[model samples]
Target: MTVATDTPLVDTHFHLYTRDMPITSWAWHHPPEDASAEQFLALMDQHGVGYGVVAAASLYGQYNDYVIRCCRKYPRLRGTAFVRPDTDMYTLERMKADGIVGIRLFFRRVPDPPDLNSPEYKLLLRRVRDLDWHVHTLVSSPALPEVIRAVEEAGVKLVIDHFGKPDERLGVDCPGFKALLAAVERGRTWVKLSAGFRMPSREAARSYAQALLRVSGGERLMWGSDWPFAAFESGVTYGQTIADLHDWVPDAATRRLITADTPMRLYFGA
Candidate 1:
């Protein structure tokens, strides 16, 4: 778990939801788990992650206070939120003050939260754009195209979580995944090369990460540990996740671009 000083990197897809947050009440069926800020920071220190993006989890519903507090504690960290349609510009501006860089729509195993093209959703995106906040989508592979089109047309930068949740059974070149790459190439889109197990490679999941890197220009991709790797308790490890990056991306410079430069540009604008 010793992270060499020279290669210190940012974890772009970490989550934070405390046990007190009524996590079980939310529609997302995952049981409540304790993931405190202090524990998270310690883990980052152990693993050599210099910073992290504490994205809002669906289990928290509209509550973002915990994630906001983490950002306040560490200047190097930032966050994303789960917001509703009627969220006003004033509210978004306040969240901006609180160190939130974007608003997320988490759609994992559940139904899509809201139609991206709906009036409420459109207005939310427009306001998010006005505040210059990016839109984070934690959706399945099948919903990527529609969400991508909606966010892009709204002129807000979009982030795709879990490498499109691609169907590993179909291989990387599957038509739906191809569309995801096309969207990234078109600009205005960013993909997180996280969640290797969710991808369809029964043998070695690393190939799934490689497929995303092949299509997503290094500048448009970000790396994350997806820490506390829920449901992957037995096999996942921080070292293994970082090592997988090697297979998916072969060059040192490209790895730096995806892990460091891209995240800095998007989250910190450095």
Candidate 2:
């Protein structure tokens, strides 16, 4: 499908995985086929995306060697990895030097979320801040307020994944979503206009995106395909994923901001 925006697109979230990579845990019964860097780049080319950020898959835990390798291999690609609070500053500095622009915190499927208020977590955030990296989180809506408060208090730039993974039934009325809006107003947080299927209905997804547009405008919002779509891969197609942006963000100017300008600034520093 042809993208309507004049500006080049950048997918702010995608993943790369191979069978050879060890899996500590998985969101589903393992993907039927590998989603490799080579395939990701081909998809980008097919869809007119000039740049991408390869977010570390939680299934691989903290084994970021492959992603680091991809970043080094492709200048147009950047990455984020799953990291523990105890991860030392030296390693973080090394990762940043290797083109990792952010650190991901996955709280959605875990039994308990990290204690963001703890000293260890605070120290990690401080180190991340010092290195000029942002915190990318995939968290449930109910936990967003605390996470938002903690990230803001730590003075780290925040990127919320998949529309804060809001409850589709509640849409904008969800308390977690309300907190997301408030966080955007604070000026340090960026929300992805992505993973529309995560919401209950297409209408709900559009409502949430429109809510963000009205409150935060395009500056604090970006677009992502969630490529290879993990467990949902069978049902969703890359073309449809790119096409959804047109539906959710109808205005060309706003679409440009989300698809190109905002992402370039956030992930590529362009």
Best by lDDT: 2
For model 1, how does the per-residue alpha-carbon lDDT over 147-260 read when each residue is reduced to its tens digit?
Answer: 778888899998888777766557575666777888888888888887775555633456656666667647798888787677675668777677666666667888899989
C-alpha lDDT of candidate 2 relative to the true structure: 0.86
lDDT of 1 at 243: 69
lDDT of 2 by residue, 1-270 (tens): 556554347888889989788887545447779999999899888777899898889888878999999998899899999888999988888888788999999886665568899998999999989988999998888889999999999999999988887865677998999999999998999999889976788888888889999997777999888988887988998778777888887888888888888888877778
What's the C-alpha lDDT at position 221 in model 2?
Answer: 93
The Cα error of candidate 1 at residue 243, in Å, is: 1.6
**Model 1 misplaced stretches (Cα beyond 4 Å):** 1-8, 24-33, 202-204
C-alpha lDDT values of all predictions:
0.77, 0.86
TM-score of 1: 0.91
Q: Can you give the lDDT of residue 174 in candidate 1?
A: 61
TM-score of every model versus the real structure:
0.91, 0.95
